[model samples]
Target: MNSRYVGYLFCGLAMIGVGSTVVVSKAIAAGLPPFSATALRFAIAFPVFIVVMRVRRVRWPRLSRRDAWLAIAQAGAGSVGYTVFLISGMKLASAADAGVIAGTLPAVSAAVAMLALGERPAPALIGAIALATTGVLACTIHFDQLSSSRGAGAFTGNALVFAAVVCEALFILLNRKLSRPVDALPLSALMSGIGLAVAIVPACFERPWTLPFDANALLGVVYYALVPTVAGFVLWYAGAARVSGAEAGLMTALVPVSAVALAALVLHEPVTSSQLAGVACVLAAVWLATFGRRLRAPSTAG
Candidate 1:
């Protein structure tokens, strides 16, 4: 198999893990304080990363001061900032709204890549972005649900969710900026440690010790740590290392598609016709973005 195809697979799976977080995080958000939950999630995953590294005999690579700071910033934006904002946002916004707004990630990531990484996208990729954005809006947005009745809180929640999207976009672009690229495992472990450090302080104010524990919430947090936080980070970095920033950005279109599907499965939300249609569109977009180049290339004469 082509390495690029493998990169796409890893990225797609990573987005699925990311999408699962929406349902999981929303479930736990009310029961767990956002900052504390973020802290605990990273804390749980950090040790697991260490164990895996030790088992694999993967030693931590030496980093320059710049790379060290870059790692910290990545943790701040993607690991800590994204989780805090997302959990906090879900407190006010409906999961559907979050999923709808999260649909912006592909565009946000592409724009950020263009601006920050100087990535000039191919025309096919641009079309894929359009298709993806439309698909997410189709899947998640209900025109009937949009009204003045939604209130200021909804707006604030949407804003916070968008903030998470931007942080994630930055996180994607920053990976491309690493002067000396670290392997996926070591980088993920480094990120988990930094995230724990950054989030634990804010978590203190939440008075985590005093909060009553909910078993379901605890389980959600544990799942988040192991799957989304640990596995998602590793898969995303591995894929991002193999692909262009723009391509990685485009892969984020899968996030909301995964979110909507998981919501139906886990929350038992009914799947709507519009949602099914949206899924089809997103799949087409993925196909176009990943294979359009080959399709456009002229075939050799027999």
Candidate 2:
């Protein structure tokens, strides 16, 4: 297989892993404080990473000061910041609102690439971003239920969710900017440690030990650590290394699609026509992003 094709598979699988865990996130959030949940996630994942490293005889790569800071910043922005802002934002926003905002990630990441990384997006990439955002809106927002009146809390929640999106975009962009690309496993281990370190402070404030905990949520946290935190991180970085920032950004369209599919299967939820349409749109976006060069050939011809 071509490395690019393998990268696409890895990226798709990583997003699916992340999307499948959304329901688990809801369960964990219901049962535990956000900070504590975030901390526990990393704490559980870190050891597994270490054990795997030992088993594989993979020594941690020594890093320069710049690379060290980049790793820490990636951990902060993507792991801690994204989780904290998302949980905090969801508290005040409707799921629909959050979903719409979260769906903007493709566009956000592309914009970051253009502004910060000096890369111009091709037309296909732009179309993919637009379609992905539209798909998310279609999946999440039921126009009939939309209220004419808005509350300040709703606005705040939406802003926070948008902040989470920005953090995530920055995370993707920063990965592309690494002075030296860290291998996915070691990077995952390093990030898990940094995430735990940063999140533990807020977890302490949550006083998780003093509170009663739900067993199901605890189980959910462990699953989250193993699947989304551990496996997702490795697959994501590995794929991102093989693709451009815009292409990686485009892959995120699969997240909501994966989430909706998992919801239908695991939660036994009815699949709405809108959701089906949204899924189609997302699929189209992915096809456009990956194989739409033919669509571009005529336009670029002199």
List candidate 1 stretches off by more than 4 Å: 1-15, 96-107, 139-144, 151-158, 231-255, 298-302
State the lDDT of candidate 1 residue by residue for 1-302, as single tens digits.
Answer: 99999899998899888888888888778789998999999899999999989998999989888988888999999889999999988877656556656766655677678778788987877877788677656754556655655645666776788789889889878887889878879888888899999999989998978978788788989999999877887799889988887688668777777787777777776767776677666666765666666667677999
Residues 102-178, candidate 2: write the lDDT tens digits: 65676667767888978878888788778867775665555454553446565666677778888988988888878
Position 112, candidate 2: lDDT: 74
Model number with the top TM-score: 1
| Clashes in predicted model 1 | 0
TM-score per candidate: 0.80, 0.78
Q: Which portions of model 2 show Cα errors greater than 4 Å?
A: 1-14, 88-107, 140-163, 233-254, 268-270, 298-302
Clashes of each: 0, 0
TM-score, predicted candidate 1 vs. hidden true structure: 0.80
